[model samples]
Target: MSALRIEGYVIVSADGMLANAKHVMPDSLRFKGDQEFFNAALDRTGLIVHGRHSFEGQPNSPKRKRLILTSKTAALAADPSNPNAVLWNPAGATFDEACDCAGVRSGTVAIIGGPEVFAMFLDRYDTFWLSQAPHVRLPGGQPCLPGVPERSPQAILAAHGLKPGEPQILDASHDVSVTPWRRAG
Candidate 1:
């Protein structure tokens, strides 16, 4: 079977909200640790998948093969200059079908997200790379995985067969922890 991986940089408060929902990646929040984790995951991934909003938020680059998933037909367009980019409508096709069309075989397929995208592929993902920011609070922020009713992300991941592998404290000042999870066979 082909492998799917869920990976994202999340800034969570002590209360468990993932981010300010208004912004996917806020400039106000520092991500030095997340950057390092992303680099490592990128090294192993052959393709990346993301929601339309996340794709739009990214800096345009031709380096990686990317698939943007959306229900709306107009959410994405071909990048004439970058032939590696593909717009995938999940309504018309399954994520696996999209990956096959993109030529992502057994190698890692990184799912970078907005919550809906994460929720969509959580069951199929083989691994998870998460950045957990400790001791912060975003009272009105959006949850990392929405609609879960304040469950521990770690426990949820464990339930999905993902075991914690590598963990490092990124910043002593901010107490952000970068952790990697691998599927238990």
Candidate 2:
């Protein structure tokens, strides 16, 4: 398999839910800094890969190429709804093929997520930019990653050889912060 530098970006609540129970980003978690950080990070990404659920309700659509990962796509094909988007099934197409379908040649690819999307790239991420709102906790929210009920996000990333850097405050008043988890040298 060819090596691809896939980076990830996510925002979570303290209890480790990427979204609330309704599977939507909570209004309480919205912050300008997190949005800005993600946008700036995307500037370095050549292609984006995200889950179908996350794509359907996106607030900020990407102007660049994207590959929406979905089980619904039996074959790799262009996404009908998006000009610069492709629908990809990893089992049906190689990463390179999917990138080609999305018109991306090479460079960093950003893995934006729902839990399933995040889990798919556990060992693939070169770095994961994790933003958090520590003040908020969604009691019955969706977990950050699936199949890792025994582990915290930190432990799961650590198992995948990712080491988190010191959390940098995104918003002091709201206790929003971001940590970059890099593949350890």
Candidate 3:
């Protein structure tokens, strides 16, 4: 079987932070245009992967299939609150096996992340939709990818061999921009 086509979607601050020091996405970090962009991406995404923290307290559970990355569970099991979500332990199931279990075939798999989740798929992503809120800054916040010297989002993407495309200015007043990067040929 062919490998999965993984794509990642993330919103970082100009300083390269994904979340505040509290490790939570605050209201200050969210922009309407970014929300719309993510919603649109979700519409076409067949499967989604995200960290446990990213899935917690989500106002509403989406209907699409989702894999919540958690090491606490060894077996894949349904989330009690959201029927469409499942707890996934990557150590136990390979991506292919997880797809098989989810009854998903070849298609775009979007990963909404916490830093580690982003780091894990560094070399596996076919595309990464990176958004930035330049006006937003959270001092001592979580870097986009941890365990390495913090760097700009572009630098991180380029290091992983992903080339950035033209950026879309989502909200000029808010300084929100989104760039789509694909693996370089």
Candidate 4:
């Protein structure tokens, strides 16, 4: 079997915030370009992994095959409501075990986020697609990664051995751009 490759997808404000102080993703961070790009990438993934908030924030989330990371679960457990989802506690079970429980044998695993989930896979991502809304800034907002406001996302990626690629303009009207950060050799 092929190794399971992990990829991350996130959009942040100029200040590196994924959500406001209330832990809500604001409309300011939403862009047509970013949404389209994100949807396309996620559609190809064998499985999606994220926190509860991230799952709910997404549209049509129940239709996707995913693992919802949550402390409420002791380990990997099937979601009663959604047959396509699994509830997982990282501390209770290994990621590989979670994948087995989720029935995703091997393929790209898309790691979408709520900060902690993003941080957990820092060392595992084959490519992290970092999209930015450069004009939006959220003070006292929830960071995309744990160290934001103290450290820039670029710095955090570099520290984890990821290198940024050329950013492509996704939305010229909103100045939304996406840069793919790949694991450095």
TM-score of each model, paired residue for residue: 0.80, 0.91, 0.91, 0.96
* Residue 44 lDDT, candidate 1, scale 0-100: 66
Question: How well is each residue in 105-153 modelled by candidate 4, as lDDT tens digits?
Answer: 9999999998999999999989999999999999999999999989999
Please give the lDDT score at residue 88 for candidate 3: 83
How would you encode candidate 2's per-residue C-alpha lDDT over 2-90 as one tens digit per residue?
Answer: 44688888888888888888888888878878877887777767888888877523444657678888778886987788888999998
Candidate 4, run of 10 with poorest lDDT: 55-64
Give per-residue lDDT, candidate 3, residue 145.
82
Q: Candidate 4 — which residues are off by over 4 angstroms?
A: 56-60
Q: What is the number of backbone collisions in each predicted candidate, taken in the order shown?
A: 0, 0, 0, 0
A best-first ranking of the candidates according to their TM-score comes to 4, 3, 2, 1
Model 2 TM-score on a 0 to 1 scale: 0.91
Clashing pairs in 3: none
Which number leads on TM-score? 4
RMSD (CA, Å), candidate 2 to true, equals 2.1
Tens-digit lDDT track of model 3 for 18-93: 8889998888888888888888887787888888888523333477888888888896777787778878889988
Error of 4 at 62 (Å): 2.7
Model 2, position 66: C-alpha lDDT score: 87
TM-score of 1: 0.80
For candidate 1, give the lDDT of residue 30: 52
lDDT of 3: 0.82
Report clash pairs, candidate 2.
none
**How far does residue 48 in candidate 3 sit from its true spot (Å)?**
0.8
lDDT per residue for candidate 1 within 1-185, as digits (tens), equals 44554454444555556556575555445567666656666656778777766642334335788888766554344545458877888777766777777777667777777677777766776667677777666666766676543687777767777789878787767887777776787
